[model samples]
Target: MSKLDSSMRCHAPVPLAASHDRNARRTLWVVILTAVMMVGEIVAGYITGSMALLADGFHMATHAGALGVTAAAYAYAKHHAESGRYSFGTGKVGDLAGFTSALILGLVAIGIGVESVVRLVHPEKVDFGDATFVAVLGLIVNIVSAILLSGDHNHGPGGDHGHAHADHDHDHAQAHGHAHHGHHHAHGHDNNMRSAYIHVLADALTSVLAIGALLAGRYLGWVWLDPAMGVVGALVIAHWSHGLLRDTAGILLDRSDAQLAGRLSAAIEGAGDVTITDLHVWPIGAGCHAAIVTVASTPILSAEVIRTRAVGIKGIRHLTIECAGPA
Candidate 1:
């Protein structure tokens, strides 16, 4: 018996995201805005001789650097998308960037916690007027940055919404689901963009907290509130960082979804007398999933027949099927 393999269903590899170019552009713009804000804050802090302003300026610089990394990731992924160097394209690049940013965010939380502890032990004199002004300015800039980074996050962080399937059979014998060839991602979540946006949100939150703490300490003599707010901000940032880390790490490691795996198995085995002997499912990119499956049947089924069974399911974009006769 002759064998025909249609290993690649797509003429070209699927894109990492539907909004790949748009998200990359948005990330670059945000990085520029953050850099500008960092410079302005540092210069103003020096002239005003306010330690709080200087601290925040330095903090902003770190996030600016992280956002710079995010921009670089996007650029690298886009330029090499069709280079054929990556076996699965550059979809996981965004996941890697998100993971790195999350680690940086975690360190920031620890640093804030330590500084707050020191401040609590040895309280600093209040230069409320200068500090408050800087906080307000930083907050405004953060808001603008947030808006620039914002997009449609309707798909949620998991990047799995009602995505259309991308199916292919090498031979012309299989004609069903041809309309679903291209990976159409209406709401593919860009992890890199989300990480950068979170940074802006964290900064804005800290600025708001700092303003309130400064006002209370200056007017009511509750100086302890300043450090207290820092602790609170640190905790909040840490929580966000942890969640981002968990999600990105899962994608990076290609964590399997048992429920999805089970469903796919049922779809194939129920098609005829086939039984799934081996199955693997993981996220490749674009809020899509790719699967490699091996099956055994009494008379041996064709790969296309098995693939056709699994088509039309949500989030499953790519599939490879192997058929072994005589289960």
Candidate 2:
């Protein structure tokens, strides 16, 4: 859509509260189920004497733990929907949790990779039967959990809180004669789903690899393959985590580090009767952003207009425009 059309005033915030109760409850249940499965897999790994299975189990444990964080964040956001402390209370919590989880995953990946390599060097006896059974079971669990979070996977991360209309100085025509078009976020569950999906997908993949290696080693006596596969799995996880962490951390710190800052500055200057004396743009949370512009002019750009222009600039969620000239 044209920037002008999309930049129109946000009619209201997304509606997230109604689904809060059900969504939170669902997240909580997933957390519990994951925890249970983690334990089960670990025990099975020991019985089967499969290092790969044990590693996969531990990975599942990490995912379960991550889900716990997701659940907690969701609950906090839901309970504090009306809190004045947050202009948008706890909405970004999921982003924070997802970012943190991704970082953790990377670390886990590195550790697993290193251990797997070591084992490969010193080939060990692994019972293929035990490991294979457990790996299959773990895969099943991952699939089920993935299905549970299907809704989240499809929607953008944000909550369905009511909408708000900021005051504006200009007399602009609405899209449909006073009607505006904008997207509403249901809740931040997408992050939760993303995190969950990552875990399950990785687990399923590593588990399959582990089963293959175990079979090959048992049948062909290629013991080194077991550890080799482990290292591969670890490296994959590490790489994935690195990207996730970097993105999340960027948002958390509200980094203004971008090549587009200059362009955005000029755009703000052109948007209204103002000389863009200064501008600061930074991310507030994942997919949400904020910018501050300093200007001097009669009937200078109102906060709403600034917001409109800023939104037109990608990644801007909230905006504050300061009029420094004569009123």
Give the candidate number with the greatest lDDT: 1
* Model 2 TM-score on a 0 to 1 scale: 0.73
Model 2: per-residue Cα lDDT at residue 50:
70
Candidate 1 residue-wise lDDT at 144: 84
RMSD of 2: 7.8
TM-score of 1: 0.90
lDDT of 2 by residue, 6-102 (tens): 3434323323433455556776777888888888778876896777568667877777887788788777766765576665445566668878778
Best by TM-score: 1
Q: Give the distance in Å from residue 134's predicted Cα in candidate 2 to where it truly belongs.
A: 1.2
Model 2, residue 182: displacement in angstroms? 9.8
Off by over 4 Å in 1: 1-11, 154-164, 168-180
lDDT of 2: 0.61
